[model samples]
Target: MDLALTAAGASVRAAAALSPRWGAAVALPLFGHVAPPRPVRVDDEPTMWRARRGRLRIPGIDRRGTEVETYEWGSGGRTVVLAHGWDARASQFAPLVRELVAEGHRVVAFDAPAHGASVGRRTYLVDWLDIFSALQERFGSFEAVVGHSFGGLAALVGVAGGIGAQRVVTVAAPADADALLTQFQAGLGYSDAVSVRMRELFASRYFPGERDPFAWLSSVRRPIPAAVPLLIVHDRGDRLVPFAEAERIAAAHPGARILETSGLGHNRILAADVVLDAVLEHIAAPIAAPAAESSAQVADREVVAAA
Candidate 1:
């Protein structure tokens, strides 16, 4: 049981009983908060040792100096940019980074604010976009931009917003920003009144002066250009971000290739052998001949042969 979640649940319920506006105001910050950053795992060590570490100062919400940790592996090859999910660091991409480097592709990844070695307690969706833009300015054009979970949505938004990349891969990612609010409401067992107020607060605070902020950030609403090849890797049994979200993403992009897996759940899907193969194949393929003329769904064990 999560003591913090439980306490938050009680607090929000109490506040909502008083006033939903107050409840939403209280819950907004919790929605942005991440758990403690994960340490480098045993499997991540080998890749970690091979990386050339660096830092980029991405201004925080209040315009304070906040430095995000960056990592690079291999050089003098097609550069592939990687973006990690919320609460996850760049090192989470160690397996994918290793394979890309072995294929002679330069790999770049960054730990978003409030994650990994970065110094912060809370981060918003716009912060992820800012980091991606900063990396693109430094790296120029990317051969591919692969993102996981929240990072996946950011990658799509960034590409749509003009970060050049020939190919894009999204693993176990949500379809839009609204999903974040929905999940937060469900997790804290808040009421619809609170949910409505939270939406108002989120939009006003995160994306001020925008008529339709969620649509602006939605992959379904503003998909990557049809010219760019897309690969959607997801697990059918994922509990964090539902498989339905991946389906919505695939439905939005006609020619997107889908690698549907089971049992790997959310985060573990990142290191799955099959998922890596699909991502690599997508990256190596010619942009002219997308993945499929239409969305193609292949099961985990058969993805390699299908690809």
Candidate 2:
């Protein structure tokens, strides 16, 4: 009887440990982290036909050795590279592209790997950085970079790594990879241990032999690169990415500007008037002349004064 009681207790403990709630908590975040199926629409052909730009094929950054498709609009001179977000196609930036071109700026846009016409099964951070590098080599340095959502994160990483750009604008960008990953995990009910493990797995698989990518955000302190100026924009009502993430990015980068507006959530913020105006303002600002790395200091002072 004693042996049977002991066996029963052990079984109960095991069952409790494997409860549905626990499983859901761990598995949910992992599952949520997986990219969702891109919606298929019938208008792809029509959209392509209407596109005023031509497509260019370039070798992908990943070892997959696939050719990625990049599209471009407008003629040369003071080029602006517009990078779209996760699960988004380059066509999504069409409105902005038209406006920029009308304002006498050339626009270059690309379909990031695994998105739109780009060739890939999946894409990671390195893929983004690689694409940016390729663009810099092929299309020349950009006067400004405008990115939406995940593209915004990629822009930050690219600019920090010295992709020559005078100004950068991110729309609804998450502050950093960790915070974004945490939110993704929480959405799926993942336990802290599982979340950490998954992050490690991602880091190992996506960035082997490389240091933590999130750390790159903090390394922009002094001796700030003269080529990169950052403008961060977020919607206060964004449910996909919290506004705090923008604030965090602003706090980390010396002269980073944060613009918070109401009504435009994650998706719609791209088209919001306030966001468009702010982007134009940032881009039209005079290019910083070569100085003793004091622009960051001056920008910080201006931000503080405005606040």
Candidate 3:
């Protein structure tokens, strides 16, 4: 465990000793906190420098003005939106941006509120939906929506919720938000009592009217339509989100194609040549014909599992 998580766990435990509600009250904000944003890698520099930079003023958790950094590249072929993972920046999709632009795609990407160059301290799942909604109004229907990790979840949710897209891709993303909260609870070594209250508070605080926040934020329960080709790429050895999540997603979306990789773990899989190739191919493929509306498997599948 890292020093920061260790210290946080200790603090939460102490608060739980006083009262589980107290621990939950303390833990909720930390759970939503977005900080120490990852720096733009040296590899991301070239693509970052080439982007047509812009900004979007979207309402945030506090219903105040928030600026979200946006980037665009290429023109005219087809527009693709790249959604980076949590605590990650738009520039992290540099390699994919280059590839898409090379194929004559007008690529659109953004750093969510509280992430990258965007200005905010806390964010939630709904923020992604809001950003996607805002972008759709500007860019019109997307040719494809590609997302990684939490952003991937947002993409699935967005497309499932009727943000038009012919193709959808999710990389190393969990199937739902509830699993992430469970992982966070485990990592913090908090008790079940604290977890229950924490979830209750989280839903009330973030999504007031929602009867079930977890289900509302789920990708599996509300999957992208079968008509839209969905590609799911996940590392078999990923330590953060287990490969089973990929299987679950694939199982839920009958016609989805799933690619399993080795060694790349969580983040590095983004730049893997195989991953990029698969994404490009999936993007370029014609929308699924009636016959193609079945689980179309791809790449090396050691398990021979139905996608």
Candidate 4:
């Protein structure tokens, strides 16, 4: 049995090295082995059904004549916006929304284009940011923004670009687009060159006339206005996004707090009590005053320091 297991592992590694898609194939089974068991969707859950409901309409960022669907619960006071990970709908945050509503906070969540009830055949970062901006505008400034996985990265970009959230929390978030692309390349057994080609292909197919979709991250990490507090929660056991990405985000942003845990993995972190508690604490904390200088000034300093 031991020999067989070893041989199987070797075969998987060989497959990963041979084909880019094989990496995902190999990683999926490992993820199932380590990740916590939970349903990915919770919209139909009884607790989520009890919360108040509202609909939102917002224009797409890059696409013309396109609108996105948004859902809101609770009142406008002390609003919290929740963004779910890739391939997940707004209902995926049902558990968190129920708890937040019980605490007297309003919650707004949306189905990313092509996910849940939202319209579109494909989804991308710009679309996610547009939805975030629209929600911030409609619901008033968000007291807190909590996002999971890819959604977490989107939240950071949106908040950095003036989404009006007082506090930000990311669960198992990749620090930047480059990190995410690297992960994909490693997982898919693709060289850096192939990864670049894949990104070009994705952008061309997804955005058409766009120069590059991946370059958006360069603009995202600019010094955030000092008023917003950022919190990142990641599980060391996560197989999809490495925990080191969270550390990088903390290192990049001054005063960003990172809470690292074990056993939660990627999706399971959503329902992890400890992760949820950290998020609640961060949101409940008092807001910091906006920075005396502009974020661009701070970002320039960061660049110089790195150089």
Candidate 5:
């Protein structure tokens, strides 16, 4: 993985050095890399197998062409929805889902378009928004929504766009489109000129009326209702997303509370006990405690046996 990323970085730098215009052309696919389907086969958690699964067709430019896979872990109760980051599938939430289920709240998580088992090769911000919209219609307003990285940004955008989740949690997520572009460039070693053109291409291609890609992401800064609470959590040591992004997000939404972690890093934040406990406290949609705990333990043993 390191070698491949290094090669990609070298290629972008070389292309940018030759011609700024052609450099942007080369970077176009990198932007598209954001939406590409990824291969993921990690299935260590047992909770994944115990859940009920369903699929919903996404309404895209081509009606009924895209579909997303959904997983339901518990029955009727205040629900907490989960959204995974780019290149991640829904099952990545197994640990957090089990905790939520143990606490007695229903948990629903879905594979975003082009990720996991969902159909299609491309996904975008709209795909995230639309999936949350569909889930909201079916589950009504969620007790809370937990999203990591790109997924975190989506939840905030969804809230702004009227997909209701009473409580919000964003972990290691970027604050704006510009922040994302800057990080991508820094990692891939793309020139500032190339990043600018890539943004232009993105704006022209997906957002016709908008000239800047950041405009589409402006919803992250839109005013959220005072009634809804948001929590912004990030690890200072994370290499993928800077902690400053979380600060900016918290600053943008005055109602948001900020939490910082130490060595857990980006993806590891999802697995930390402290993070799970913090999330449970914010949502406070507990199930019948002792019974729920026993059932959750049984489910875990079943999962291990099945594995």
Candidate 6:
């Protein structure tokens, strides 16, 4: 979140936090920075689930030394990055994080720039990509990258930028960035002029290259780097992001698979047993190996071939 942008946004955000009525203004200039991340909520896990928690400071990105909050679990070679949705903290993934660790994966999750225990009180959807890029630089290649909602969209941005990843998973991700903007406008009851100016401002802040973020939302036409196994998960009952969005993502990526669950709404999908099982199996599934043969079997096979 860039506090240097506008005072109206900051003041409105502060007011919005106190009263939900002001939340309609979230779309104006400070859409992403409208709210601070909710405080860390610890889950009731076994004592063994202790995480190596800390902050990562990048000199260039955060001039004020705003090291972002980060948490890690497991020490296995296979690393999986977990990205939670908009306005949510990294610890929200505690349930999934434990499961991933138990499945023998080194898991890393973080609160985005201004969220969670990180510095600052503002954030933007575009900054999510930057966070992933910074983490990828420090962590190297990931075995799998998992994202939900807005975070899922950021995962797409990372993939487009060639962040090293073996597999990608998105849960209830938006199909188009333009759609997000429209939703924001409608949510705030803002006019077309506001939407247009906001787009210009957003472009300047994040996509200065004149690149289209909406296109990037579904950017798998060429399958970003030719190919990367993708899993798109969504629930038909989700009210926040529709199930059709997942279908569109699947359609964009030729081989991308879509898994639709039931009754898990938008947020509850993270806790559903079926969703957890699917994600675990996808990332933890091993490559097939040739069957080992005993000397007697080898001899028998050789004899049979000779005969």
User: Against the correct fold, how does model 5 do in TM-score?
Assistant: 0.83
Winning model by TM-score? 3
lDDT of 6: 0.68
* Deviation of model 1 at 135, angstroms: 0.8
RMSD per model, one decimal: 3.0, 8.4, 3.1, 8.2, 9.0, 11.8
**All candidates: TM-score:** 0.93, 0.77, 0.94, 0.74, 0.83, 0.77
Model 1 lDDT per residue over 90-187, tens place? 88899999889889999999888889988888987788888887887888889999999999999988898888898999999999988878888888
Instruction: Tell me the spans in candidate 1 whose CA falls farther than 4 Å from its real position.
Output: 289-307
**Among all windows of ten consecutive residues in candidate 1, which has the lowest summed lDDT?**
298-307
Residue 182 of model 2, lDDT score: 77
lDDT tens string, model 5, 126-161?
A: 788888888888989888889999999888878876
Clashes of each: 0, 0, 0, 0, 2, 2
Q: Which stretches of candidate 6 lie over 4 Å from their true place?
A: 1-28, 41-49, 58-65, 209-213, 217-223, 286-307
Instruction: Kindly report which residue pairs in candidate 4 clash with one another.
Output: none
Residue 7, candidate 2: how far off, in angstroms? 32
Tens-digit per-residue lDDT, 1-307, candidate 2: 3463344334433433566344434442232232443553453444444455544444454464665667666677688998888778777776676678778887888777767766565665566777778878877888898988888887887887788888888888876677666765554444565555666655655566767745764323322264567788887788888877777667666566677777767876776666676788899988776546443453332211111
Q: Which stretches of candidate 5 lie above 4 Å from their native place?
A: 14-18, 34-44, 60-64, 211-213, 285-307
Superposition-based RMSD of candidate 6 using all C-alpha atoms, in angstroms = 11.8
Model 4, 36-150: lDDT tens digits are: 2234344456755564555555555445646656667777489998988776777777778777877888888877766666666655677778877777677778898898888
lDDT tens digits, residue span 171-271, model 3 = 99999988889999999999999999999999989888889978858876887777888889999889988998888788778767888888888998888
Estimate the overall C-alpha local distance difference test score of candidate 3.
0.86
